[model samples]
Target: MKDIIILMFRLMVCIFEIWMLFGFYNNFLKNKPRKSRNNIFIILVFALIIFAINSIDNTILNLICVPVVYFVLAIVAFNGNVFKKLFGTLIGTIVILGTELIIVAVLNITSKELIESSMVNEPSAFVLTIIVKMVTFIVFEIIKQFSSKESEMMDGKTFCLYILTPLSCLGIMFSVVFCRIDFTENSLAKSVLIIFFFCMLIGNAAIFYGYNRYAKILVEKEKNRRTVMEQKMELESYKKVNVANDRYITLLHDTNHHIKTVYSLLKKDKKDDAMNMLSKLFDKYEKAEMIEYSGNTILNTILSDYKEKSSKENIECDIFVERGFNIEYVDEIDLVAMLSNLLSNSYEAAAKSDMKKIRIQMFMQNDGSFSVIKIENSYTSMIVEEDSVLKTTKQNKEFHGLGIKSVQQIAEKYNGWLSSTWSDNVFKSVLILENSMC
Candidate 1:
């Protein structure tokens, strides 16, 4: 019964160690924390196979088993890049095995006879083994966490940490081996307790370091997001001011022409014709001023700006927009960025074509759950390549390639969707965004 218990304890310790190592590799090394359930099951099976191998005494079997397990783990880490995966797993396994050997050596030097005796069916000895393995696992996990964050830095701090952390673990193990402790009358339980406490101290230190680094990363990312938001707001304000100024200037200039036309008609004594012409011109001018919509001012400005540019290039522009869209679902800046990229691309494409025509349609659904925007233009050739990027032509290299990628990024940021296709010599792009207003 005592022998059975010892075997069971060893099995459990091995399984736990494997679990921690594989979990760390999957999370920190692969940078994929959210794997499927199938992957977890596969790792567990592999760990069990490794644990079972200790029962086998055949040297050939042990040699083959170790490499196979490491190979499987490497495949998981390197996403099936056999050479890199094998190399990394081999290095990691060597470090782990080396640390274990050092631990055994230290215990031997400190209390050779006592350690050998303690290994014989003592529950306390098994507990000490568990404590050591757990502590080592935690230390390695901490190193992995810190190393991941450090990798993002411009400097080589993370790389230095990675190199130093494993070395430090090795040094600690060696120190414990070299320092002899006279365990003359100390109970195995008491000795195990002391080692457990020391291991806990090391684990705690690692936890502190990992948390501090993780928190710093969070703070930096938050600051960057805020700065981006501020810049976007400033750009939107500038666009509004420019649009308002241009509208005012255009109105002032048109008023003088209106007055001159009225005066000439009256002098010709064609009073009825002059009144009719004045009424039509006044209605047309008023309609021009009524383009702005309150709910989505940024989108309105973008459309208006593109419309003016298209008119200058002699590209016929057709736009139909439904009023009173719910702006609650998207920030003004993101909305502006999305529309600006899409419309600018359309205008540029249309300008390059022989037909030179573009059509834009935007509307909010009746359910108020989504907003749809579509832009289509006549093109001399297909716009997108097989990879779904705008194909560049010698005449329009500057603006042809980036529009689709920009729109896709904006859509992803807002939890929206974008798709484009070409058919019948016409290019069409469609965007759908969840209406946060609902």
Candidate 2:
């Protein structure tokens, strides 16, 4: 009966360890969209396999087979590259081995004879396993809090900063754990030692929780900065449009007088002078007509501004918009920012290319449920890309890449996405928005 009870405890520990590994993988890597039943099945299968491997009582075999099983499970259940999955598996394996080693090392120091007893039927061995599993669970929970679901993209510097606290705590823990302190007959001292270890674990978790909060504040600050910049740009564009409107109103007020003067010139046989007058009038009207591309006022202004800029660079623009189409879901400032950034990128890229052409097409999908905006431009050279993101090839790299990122943020803000592709010197960008009515 005692043997059976010990077996049950060991089995429970094995299953708990396996569950922790799965939790680690899910938190460390992006998980696939799996049904709960399927997820539970995968966990059960992994638990059974790991339990069987542990039953062999061979460290080498357990290490080799256990990580292999986890690696396979990660591949099946996660959505990341092979290297990322391998890295997650490696971390799990290390935690498993490290915690078990810490447990045995500490227990042996306290009582070598108690540590030497067979692990299967010894109550002390069962307690040791429980302690190890408890520590592992705490470590796993700390990691889960550190890696957030919204943004898993931690920079190297931040990752280093995040890891420093835990490493320091672990060092202190080990120094104290390995100190020469005879606790064989001192039950109170041993209990205090265990409580101290738990305190360290709790401290590490608290530190990481603080780090996550600080990271979120940094993210919010960046967003606010971006929002302010967008508003500034929108204000500038609207000022230009307002100036053009003023000129247009003045021109309309003087229309009758201008027409009479032209007719008078024609009557006097000053045909050349009349033609010049008409030409000048036409130039003024053309400038005033620039802001008439889209039904949305903000979009029209942005398109007009970019169109004029592109024309200065001798870049041909082939823009097509479906009649009466409007972007109803996005905010005015966001529309200006997103469309302006996209066109600015296209203009810069196309201006340097031999073809010197840009194309934009906006229309609702066939089902009328989605709005599609496609932009294509010509480029002479290969585009630079980093981590699957298109990087700016300009000489000044400091402030060039945020335009694409801004567009993506706005797209995602409105249940949309931005995608870009390039093939044979023609770069393409497609933006899709849900429920953007015409």
Residues 1-438, candidate 2: write the lDDT tens digits.
Answer: 757755665665666677678768877677799787888788878887887888889989987898899899898888988998998989888888898898787767775545343322343344455566656766776566567565644666776776676666566654543443445566556556655655655566566557656877978887887888899889988997787679788999988888999999999999999999999999878877765666777777777777877888898988888875558777778878888888888898899899999999988885767788999999897688888888887777766677898899888877889999989899999998887553
lDDT of 2: 0.76
lDDT, residue 167, model 1: 50
Candidate 1: residue 243 Cα off by (Å): 3.7
Query: What are the lDDT figures for the candidates, one per model?
Result: 0.64, 0.76
Best by lDDT: 2
Q: Write the per-residue lDDT of candidate 1 for residues 1-438, one digit (tens) a residue.
A: 757856766666666656556655544355344456856666667767877886776767876787678767656543534565666567557656655666566665676564555333354455346446644664665555555544233234544564455456545543443443334466654456545544554454465447546866976775465446546744965666576668668877887887788889899998998899889777666545535744555666667767767877999999887776566577766666677667767777789888898999877775878888989998875543654455655467553454556567668766788998877768899998877667
List clashing residue pairs in candidate 2: none
True-vs-predicted CA distance for residue 138, candidate 2, Å: 4.0
Deviation in Å, model 2, residue 126 alpha carbon: 17
